[model samples]
Target: MTAAGLPMEIRSEGLPTRVRIHEVGARDGLQNERTVVPTEVKAEFIHRLAAAGLPTVEATSFVHPKWVPQLADAEQLFPLLGDLDPQRLPVLVPNERGLDRALALGARRIAVFGSATESFAKANLNRTVDEALAMFAPVITRAKDAGVEVRGYLSMCFGDPWEGPVPVAQTVRVCRALLDLGCDELSLGDTIGVATPGHVQTLLAALNEAGVPTSRIGVHFHDTYGQALANTFAALQHGITTIDASAGGLGGCPYAKSATGNLATEDLVWMLHGLGIETGVDLDRLTATSVWMAEALGRPSPSRTLRALSHKE
Candidate 1:
């Protein structure tokens, strides 16, 4: 049975009975690595994630090789991933050119990212926040015309690297812009992993008040200070039903030096299952996938829960 088939009576108070997990280990998780992961290895990692029952996985980014050489194999990787179940894979497209490349390679889904903080926008995309939003408009329109599903990302929603704390107002404004641009869904990112439960509550409240439905907002938290799970719970209380996580805590923010890895998929699934939240993911299978990915990366799995469970076994 899928996770949605599970009994829902055990869910936490105020928590959504079901949640969607957008796995990003193959793309966001690997983008910052110094060593280039071979295209075959990347494809194999994605296959393992699919076997773990992830409904959506960000397969790779279609950015310029000059900016992120780790994903320079995108053109090669996409074709290699042709064997994957097309219903689950989405590629990141940084601009119209990137989207065009993805389309040429037969990509059906794409993600465009902007930032709530001006400095982060400038540093990451070489444009101001508004400029980045403006840049995405044409891309979003063209993609819609092509019948491609588009997901928007608002990075540094909680805090910025150059600037200190980000205002809730700023995040809401960026979110409104992305929605107005016709993005199907928006992932609000805690780029630096500096958010607390209070910050999550405040931001969600502001977004809610601004007329953004919780169903359209997805939370992407980093576990830099071990606050990811807490923030995620807080988001759930505010009616968020979708989350973005990396396998084995595999990713970190490139713009924030102090930021650690993303929320571990094993840990998140463990918590969600305990809460009886349906995620359509098998915890045991996901834990095994995390272990395999860690071995492939030549690093210990960053999930404490997975490590402890493995030790017990």
Candidate 2:
């Protein structure tokens, strides 16, 4: 361990050789913003992310405009991403209605949202835990039949804002349902960011015991408790390679006011690259894009890497 007491990234072993970062800045990152970003600007931001070589960018959500006003123009925004590879741009779909809208617009890849805790499911989706999974069942099946790949999101895997700590078995059960519904992959989200390294390791180990392969799971973390990176490191050491991050640390959960933004892509890239793990991201170009995006948002980026690098210019 370093003098700072942080776990050092081991170059020789116990680390992934490559990591696939699922970029969520354009969708989850911007969804709750109070300011209305122009549809074209949102499109351009995604374009920049793709150009920076993000493997998968959550482009937009097909949820009702009344719920998330910021991304109300999903229809308009999706058309702008026509030039990007279809698989690289996945849109969030709450149910069949959202799924139909996305499919009508040529979206081949989509994400179905669920929750591990009943409190968050009720507050966010207005449905109980079982009800939410019931809702996602048909959505996931229909999407798969349409030749559209489905990625599942299970929020509040670690803890919930309304309900305190979530049980690992509850998380595993929810994840199993999503996968059984035929979701190609599942992103376990620490919606409130209350997860620590020990929590991360325990969760993954429990999921493994539940018969979920590490290859099919990705972790989405928030830096709210300042444990995102440490938790990610723990996950990596435990043989999980996929991670979800936002550019410039751009998103925060609307339900939790005290929570900070999602783990920053630049910050994750800095650590992964330093540890000799390949992510195929251009750090300099990505940093420039973050600076550009911060200017567009009319604020400095929250990424310490982006902040320090921005000052060097």
State every prediction's TM-score relative to the real structure: 0.95, 0.96
lDDT of each: 0.88, 0.89
lDDT tens per residue, model 2, 1-313? 2442223655748788999999999999998789999998898899999889899999999999999999899999899889988899999999999999999999999998888988778888999989998998889889999999999998899988777899888899999888888999999899879999999999999988988999999999999878999999999999998999999999987766656799999999889977979899988888888888889989988898888777766
Runs of candidate 2 exceeding 4 Å displacement: 1-12
Per-residue lDDT of model 1, residues 1-313, tens digit only: 2343322335667788988999999999999888889899999889888888899989999999998899999999888878876557889898989999999999988999899989888888999999999899999999999999889998899888788899889899999989999999999999889999999999988888998888889999999888999999999999999999998888886666777899988888878987888888887778788888788788898898779667866
Number of colliding residue pairs in model 1: 0
**Model 2 residue 105 lDDT score:** 95
